[model samples]
Target: MEIYRDSKLILEINDKDVNLQVFNEKISMPEFNNVCKLNPRVKITDFIALKKLLNLDSTEKTKIGELKEIYELDISKDEMVAYLKIYLTNSEIDRDVDKVKTDIISFLNSKNILEGINHELLNSDIPSCKKFVVATGKAPISGENAKLVYYKLSERKVKEGTDGNMDFYDVKLIDNVEKDDWIGEKIPPTLGINGKTLFGKIVEPKPGKDAQLKYEKKSVYENPENGNYVLRAKFAGAVKFDGKKIGVDNHLVIHGDVDYSTGNVDFDGYVTIKGTVADLFSVEATKDITIEGKMGIGAVKFIKSRDGSVSISGGVNGKNTTKISAKRDVYLKYVNETSVVAGGDIHISQYSMDSYLEGKKIILSPKNGRIIGGQVKADHKIITGSIGNKFEKKTVVNVKGFERVMIKHELDSIEIILKETIGKANKLKRQLEIFESNKSRLEEKALNTFRALIINYDNIMDEIARTNIKLDHLEDMLKTRGDGEIKIVNGVYPKTVLEIKNLQRKVNDLMSCSFYVKDNELHLYD
Candidate 1:
């Protein structure tokens, strides 16, 4: 019988006699004869030596049936699958199909690769001369995160005209939104798919994160039909979206001049005029008013909020016909031939010419602060660099006198009415007391007269009480007088009049001094 051990040749006779054992690459004739001697019943033709059958030389180390399995196995960290690699050291060696398949199966099972196993490479003929991959694994697909997509109306830009002429009407100053206008849409996150490993293990992918929309409740709301957020304009005006929050403001913006083309604007909210307010046109706002350009000739602008302010980047060059009023502070680049009023402080960056300006406090820039031919009134202080021009133009600076005069006049009127009411009440009370003492059960005419007298007395007393309250209020206002001052930084030229409270003084020369009311007299500090 013939036997193979480690791909070497072995000859056995019956069950007990062992003759030849050849492990070397080459075998001599003596070795072959010895193998025949050991197995007398076995014909040499029936059993052939491994080295002789493969025709190998003595220097070679591998035989035809003695090839060792040389292969590599790699498993991914994600447990997606395993890869099988096979190589051959000798290209002449015939590969064992069953052994290669079994070895590859054992390797994959060792690495716990139990699912998605490709059996085509295992069942097909594998080349021994080159290396090849046998198996592959699948990876999971990731999902996208949620995002917000804004509508067109929320970010509309100004359209330029192609007519070759610069038209201010082509610019869109404000982004307007109507009620139930689509503002933005929210895209929801998607769920990730599950993946399988080469080792039959499950791999779960991370899901995308979700995002919520933020907006003002009164100005925007989420639509139930499409799950999109839309703008709900509480008032017809401008719309704003700050990436996070969406809001709508009650305002009207004019892109062009307020003229016959665009009628006078009367908005309940803020008003922003990008162009000039034309002559004889009026722009009024219940809130704030912002004029980006200069006020045209004879134009009028007003703001009504005591807390809201007005800003005119371009000065009011109204030629004595432009009138501007602000309930709060007024900010201007310059004022010329205009009348301006503010409840709070007024800041003028440049000179004022022939303007009547009134506020709680008026300040002009010291660099170009010239109040020439203007009557400036402030409750507290009036600060300017030059009071009059080089030609000694007539300029008047009055401080803390308007409110005092008005309050005093009101107080006087209330006192006179109060005195008359008291006199009338005393007269009616005396008449009523005399009538009541005259009779207990008087005639109808007398009773009616007595009741009338009592009514008149009570009415007069109420009137006196109301008048006293008014008088007390006015008196308190008069007592709290501001320490008003006229601060002249550079100088006050001749013919410039300075008034502090009730006292007035004319500067006859180039005087650099601060004037204030002291002891009912205008005092000057140089």
Candidate 2:
């Protein structure tokens, strides 16, 4: 430390401590000549000396007392500031005008000011607050209250009892009130991350640790304009942040663009897409999603929920589901879902028999697209956009591009041809003789296969006969009608009838031409 006459620090140091190889001999007290820039590490002697110099009780007055006497000193009752003179000489109470105001209001309230006042934003275009008990200007106040009231009212409401402009509003100029004795005011609470001040209690965030509150989450104490009021976050270790951390459980907003390409993001929280989510990403969350920008080109969007799913605007062929199945709704611009239920009403815009739809009730959009597959079962109602169907229930379909769907038979010729192909393919030893050339059982097996083939052929012949009878009936009906139009029901198109008949006839003809085979028979069914 140093002391100066004209302009220099009157330096003082323990001679022994000052000169030593291990001491590093590197220390300067800015208070030298009335200037003391701080060093992070204060030597033990410095700490005691400085404390004594600034403490409420100092024995042999230090230069600080001399400095205060030489320079007009108006240090507020801030022990912290007194502890370090650097700030005391530079900053003034006027700089904390809002704090002064809050102290006065709080003091007035505790002391029972004429009337109670609700604190709000200090600069609002329209008054966000009003004095219902007394007309404006009736209470003892000044121009600042007039100017500050406007803001208090215009700013949005904060958690139950916090002021807007600052933890405390400016009180340096309030008439008939003490600036330092507000009912619940204390030294302006220490401002930390997000400018949050703390000094009382801790609250469990709604979503628990890291839960982001949509609104200001702190609870404030509002008292009648009287005693001191102070706001402080007592917990020193709690991490405070800036801007807003959004999420169902916890949300985050990146000021810059985000590039996320994880296999899946599963959270028991809410997610927000401020920038484009470039690819089809999967997310499983307990709550909802809000997409601020369009999902980039060529990406599919899918959301999974355990409770309920909500998307501000969404997509097609893409499905969003939730385990809470009931009361879940999917709103989209252009999309398809077999079922949607809101308050128990299920709605389907377009659906195919092959595509399954199951719900408590359904409402179909007036618009309808082609449906090639699945079952539609709803307990309530079904609406339609436009009915496009082949009128046949075709399974295993993707109903994508082909307009005017039709029932295309999926032939499983394996079962039908199995018996015939295998039997005709079996080995034969009949020419040698039943007893000498072949084993008795093997001969029987061959004859049995051939006989079964004959029966199968006969069955085809019968089918042909039946088909002809039907054809004749159709012809007779056409003749009977003599000019009326034919009605097709259940997709029994004329072509379908023709296909069956043609296939049946061919089978009959093939059966008519018998054949015998040797070893290595084909077991088509197996």
Candidate 3:
């Protein structure tokens, strides 16, 4: 059987015999014959025959020696890597590097390692008697997971002062969006590319995992233009995180102090100020308002909520400088010289010192809450831990039968205005009467002035009629009465005036009692 063949010689191995035939007598043929004799697998028994054949261009096969073993080829268990080892001596394997490479390729083909052959390394010099990594397998690429890509809103940059310094407080912390504005989109996962091994075995890749976009349907909706993965705002407002979902809220938030940086916030939504409001500034909102920081004297001209409530965690140190109003309720840590009016209730956690508080009900914390040296009025009831201090600060508490006093005061004021309107109308009528008497004898300009006077008279009469209707409505409200009370838990010291409805009780002695109206008179229950 033929073991190896080349252009110049043919090497054969028979039963216990090695043969070599040199068909061409070229300059390198003798060298090739010598290399063939040097193969350790074949021990030369007739070196003279091989030399005679190389010298004589003989094509006839001749026996030279017997065989031992062949070169070794190793493949990894996974068949991902392959290595070849030439076990012959260095001098025996010394030949043209190209021919060696050809022999290696032939061996690899026989061993079934046809893929990923390292041709570059094979093209260079290879060592003998040492394992050489001749092939490598390709690795599969993993797919990327799904992700969300948010659209860019405003840059959170601050304004530069005249000296070129950045105004840190002016940086925008909230992202605002208009109705139908795109917010973000989910990017789908991808399928990865496959790979192969040294044995040409196929490798499957891992597909990426998909994800859903989190959002609220009320404030955010899927954009029809880009399918369900894309999101858009449903209203014009601030963008915020509603729990775990991203949403657009009808609420404005001030992350820092509300000063020149955020000019007097006047939003038509819920407002939350994490910091203090500066002096002379005002905050007005259509919904609830919350102030996390303290309100100093003159800090704000007014903090008002048109249709919701107000809560101040750090209390008010207004010093009679700010007016706070809410349609529903007002919650405060403490009140110091501030005037607050709420249509629902005023809840104070601590002392209310020299502050004018008016609400449907005034509630102070029963633990240590106190009211000292201020007018407190509630339409329903007033509950406090203490009423007056030891020094007799003369605090006044009024529970006036479900806004009866408030309605009476409004009615009185409107009656006074009505009286003025009637008087103005009578005066205008007398002036018009004098003009009508002289109109026939007056010139064109005089007649025009007379006509204007008559119209003014009619307008004043209409004003009087409207004022009378408003007064009548307030008077009717005063007639619709309800129960009212004032309860003092700890003590009502001397000089404290407690009133219920039209009755009054002066507490000259320290007493803890509930004052209510009974039998058309004020009664105290201890």
Candidate 4:
């Protein structure tokens, strides 16, 4: 079967003695029927492997010289495998492949591999280079101290010398991607001094540049495949796009939508997002801030609050030299890892260690809260968690270890079982049992009722802690009451004093605890 340059399909045939793989790459075909052109010694298996290794599918654009300019490159098999990787993978590979490819190009340019190779390539507008060794890591290792093998790819020739002895490979390179299809095309073996070696050409910058630098601009280039604008220059200022005369730190405006979905919402003014502020419309306001909604993922800021204290309340997004401030006593109730100059005290309820905080004094209420300044300096208390971070009655509380339990869980915080509620239930049950039990040995159901009352005592304490009910005369009732209880009728019946002095005015603190300790060894059961 004869291979044509028109298609991507590879046909293999075997009639009697001869077996062949017909590759559609025209440059790889023989120059004559009688004389072997180049690397005729290379096995057909290796050619098929190289094609597969390059990851060239039948549909990945096989036509050349139309959308892409055609090229007939000459290189060695080893170097070809290394260079072809760029187009084969979606992103850049490791540094070793780049280094090897660079060496081949350098060698060709210097004309050290084969004399007139560089001249011929240059005359054809194909800039080639010769590989050379440069020292890194202070100095080269001494000859007597190092021994390594240096092998040639063109010839299976291994040369021995001091530790630093080395020679380089050569390659023919074509620049100008649109005009040169050589970038993605596989070259024949004749590019090297010895015809047995094959190398692949890539559409890229010069040798040193390809190995060291990366291509990453917003408007500099247009990817024919991706159809997106590559950055031409580094960004200098913020650009908020909502069609308003936004405060730009720089100039030259474009479409600015407040969503990280495309890029980032770059702004230098007060960002007022009418939408959910889904991106938090992160801004660097030399003044203060006010987001009607919550901050989206990865949103950061250096904002000033209405409160004198500069508070952080979102993920770090844009860099702001301006101090972060709040309106009232800035409540870090919902602050995250965003930094702030914090001219005033910083209230940190829960912040990430990755967050940087600088303030007159940081009031941390997070678990195991850490400080990174040379010295921890706080004038007031450094509450790690809530003094009673909860809500009871109508008052909110900050409680120790309150961070462990969630208070805002869907409808759970509202449905609380207070100590008074439990006591009322217990009293009703006990009265029912006394009037209802009809046996000497208490019925199992009655026993179960009593057990449930006992079981709920611990929960009662948890409710008290959760409610933070600081009843003014509660101690008096529990401690200094009359023989039974004088506050209400049939006080032993355990009815809640709903109208006690200053009740329902205390804060809430939800922490679970039960048996009151009488001594080192309490007169208590479990």
Candidate 5:
């Protein structure tokens, strides 16, 4: 029989179950409760089911006061988490909260979910009618792979100096290693830790992989200073790394030109090139470098030695594009439009035309070796066939060499700068004088302009004073040191500038002569 009837819903109670039918989709809870309030025997044991049926156009039945059927427990597929859902109950039903909590705990314990359980949720006043995360498991972490650390050379192709010149000699294509130098060290991998699950099962973490250290056993040795895996060089050589292996190369020989096929030659030890070095290709070494083949009318990029000498059997036609630097002497057959810097003497079999040469002493074949249209500097003496050509091509010979020439150039640059600075200061001073009487009557922009002129003039004056002091110092240095001599075996033509210390004399008439400094005077003798 129907106990409560409304326009949208009907509720009936029987011995087996309580039935509910929702005629309308929108039904109120107060309407159902009003019917229950009139009959004390009718009670809501499952408020969740009754509330769900009130908003649906269907019929559903549920047992009164059946607490066990209202609970739901679920475990995720991975078993890493567990969820518990409890349906709503009514105050009118006789029930025990602790008994329900005890049943849930017992059920979780039966499933072996003791680890990572949320105890606070089980002990607190848990809100019903919704699912809650009751337990969580930890995830396994991955270990980092092993790595190698070692000394690495700079990868920059050109290093710029403070003087705004590119230092090609400083670039190292191969990393140079000394005896007992550290090559690299292999760091061991870490052992991974195990994880846990909601069921107290062990989850293994991923282990790191070890990387193999490949090297030549004869050229490299394991260091025993500490209990670490470190490799060191057995002798001095260049470091060679070929993706899978590493070793030290003492002597390297190139059978062909240093072109696209060979790239660049950079070795720690001696290097010998059987053929010519192609244009835009560089060869650098710590020891001596020898180029046996003739340079085939092309410019060589650069050739450098850190602690040894350089020798080119074939002549070099650099075309103003080549540079050779060596710590010791340099021997060349003939050079044109090239720049050579040597710590010791430079010996040339033929002539050097339109090339920059700097060394302790520059010597050429006295019979026919000529220097034309270029700057040549030597600290000791310059022995050449001729100073300049008969056509009066400009050729500058500095007997006092590198330091003196650099100082003179710096001083000349400073003089030009001083002249410009003084001129600007004078112009600004005149502009400031014009605005002196009308300072207060000027506009904001005009006043700013007047103030800027005064500041710029003061700054220029300060710069001029500093430059004068520097000029005095350089002039003193130039006067005290100019003792080298120049011996021209052939003839010194016009447009040839001879510099001894700081004194410069221009050659006008063609004359075979030798110039020397005595008693602060440059004397020329035939």
Candidate 6:
């Protein structure tokens, strides 16, 4: 037993087979088989305890059957890490732990798994019999991108009143900014971190991209501090952000009423009035005009930009003396006893009383959009909730273009003139014929009258011919004009006149209908 304990068996693993060296001590085959069972890759099919039973005296190296090499070391495609797996086979040889460890380390070094090695897992008991995770790799963390934080603007509309008025105080009419006010800030991008793989390969992360700040001239300034950018206003005015650029327009602000003391204001940029535009006062702007208070009697307001639109938060009480014109669209809370002309569309939120409005299109509010006691002319369509009052004070709605109306009027005038001229020409022709027939029986004065009558008749005939030609041309033009329509959502009162092109219809009773031109006549449809 001492000899058996003092002697050791040498094991070697090669590419094809495992070999063992037996010392000159009595060896128990059962003990060797038990040790072989520790390696999953080694198994014994037949065991004869020859050394213990026969007491063998020879000490020689013997060859064991092939180890089968069923398992392999797996390396990831990214060369990040490595793993080892072992499989059972028919062999009776105890595996050498030191030799297996050296082989695993050599394989990992060949695949470049130089970092994050799990040595304890590699040296664990019966490591070859189980799957072993030998290495792990780190992944890089990317940095955040830059962003723009803008100061948002207010988005509130005018509030409606119970007394058929609009509350202008609820609307945010201006986004005023003082000089050196912070408009926006640029959140800078952070630097990226470097990373490494289990194969000792260096990974470079992509750095965050930078963006520049854009601003209008004399409106904003860019400030850079500690790798961060900020945008500040340069002058006191109305600030606006147009997606890519920030701008400020000089605004003329009137704190008090636009009365005789304020006179008339004509600005090239934006205008904001805190109080009412009193009677007979005029306000004009090349860009936008905002009135915080109500529009008084006889006030005049105009916006010149063909592309710019106007928004009137409060109502207008024109008292038959006010006039408003915009080259583009006009949005109003309410209008009373005024004349309005817009090159584009007109949107009236509330009621329009005794007002004359003309535009490409006229649209009234969905609720309480009433038009009473005046005329509305639109080139395309006139949409309203109600037209005319209960008493029927003669409201007129013309859906034809103004140019067509003027042309039709001209044609009528020409026809009247042509009738008068033709009648005069016929009378002169008869008189001249009578004078020629009695030429021999007339005195010197009568002969002179006959000669003068002949010339006068010829002149009248020429004039008649020219006038007839002009009338024909105007009639052709009237035939070529396009048609327009009027749509009343609620009702049209009696005595309300609806006209399209040259056709006109007078409402004798309340009717909710749509009026359009068909076959040169105004037709009403449900």
The best candidate by TM-score is 6
Model with the higher TM-score, candidate 4 or 6 = 6
Tens-digit lDDT track of model 1 for 1-526: 4542334455444343333444556555676555433323333321344444334432332222222235666666765656555644222223467776787777777766667677886677665534455565666666666676764442222222353212223223346667666666677766678777675556776665555555667866776445434345555665665444666668777887778998877776667777777777787776667677654334454333433567776677776677778776777777888888997678777778999999977888754578999799887678777899779899888887445566677788878878888888778866765675465779989999887876676567667766775676455445443446777878899999888876889888888777776556667776
Worst 10 residues of 4 by lDDT: 167-176
Residues 201-311, candidate 6: write the lDDT tens digits: 777766654444556757888888667788888888877764546788787888987779888887777778777777766788776667766653345553333334566
User: After superposition on all CA atoms, what RMSD does each candidate show versus the true structure?
Assistant: 26.5, 39.0, 28.1, 33.8, 26.6, 27.1
Question: Any idea what lDDT model 3 has?
Answer: 0.75
lDDT of each: 0.65, 0.29, 0.75, 0.29, 0.74, 0.69
The TM-score of predicted model 3 comes to 0.42
Candidate 5's TM-score:
0.40
Worst 10 residues of 5 by lDDT: 163-172
Question: Which candidate ranks first by lDDT, i.e. highest?
Answer: 3
Model 2 spans with C-alpha error above 4 angstroms? 1-249, 252-263, 274-280, 291-302, 312-314, 318-327, 336-355, 367-372, 390-526
Ranking by TM-score: 6, 3, 1, 5, 2, 4
Please give, for residues 109-194, the per-residue lDDT of candidate 4 as tens digits. 45323322332322232222222122111111222211111111122122322432211111101011221111111111111122
Models 1 onward score TM values of: 0.41, 0.25, 0.42, 0.19, 0.40, 0.59
User: Can you write out model 3's per-residue Cα lDDT over 1-526, one digit (the tens) per residue?
Assistant: 8867777778888886888877765426557646655555666777677667777656688986777555677778877788777756665556566777788888888877778899988776677767889888786787776777765544433343453322333434346688888887887777778878887888877766555566778889876353337888998777765223577769787888889998988997778788888877899998778777654324478999998778776778886788999997887777888899998778777789998999977878665679998899987678788998999899988887755556677777787778777788778767765675456799999889987886676567667656765675455445433456777777888899988887888889888777777557777776
Residue pairs of candidate 1 with colliding backbone atoms: 80-197, 80-198, 81-198, 113-199, 114-199
- Writing each residue's lDDT as its tens digit, candidate 2 over 211-239 gives 11211224222232323233222211111
Off-target runs (Cα >4 Å) in candidate 6 are 1-77, 80-136, 156-173, 225-227, 295-297, 301-307, 378-382, 398-487, 498-506, 513-526
Error of 1 at 148 (Å): 22
lDDT of 5 by residue, 213-314 (tens): 657888888764554578899988667654335677686778887889999888878787778888988999997787777653257689999977787877
TM-score of 1: 0.41
Window of ten residues with lowest summed lDDT in model 3: 164-173
Model 1 residue 331 CA deviation (Å) reads 1.5
RMSD in Å for model 1? 26.5
Q: Candidate 5, overall lDDT?
A: 0.74
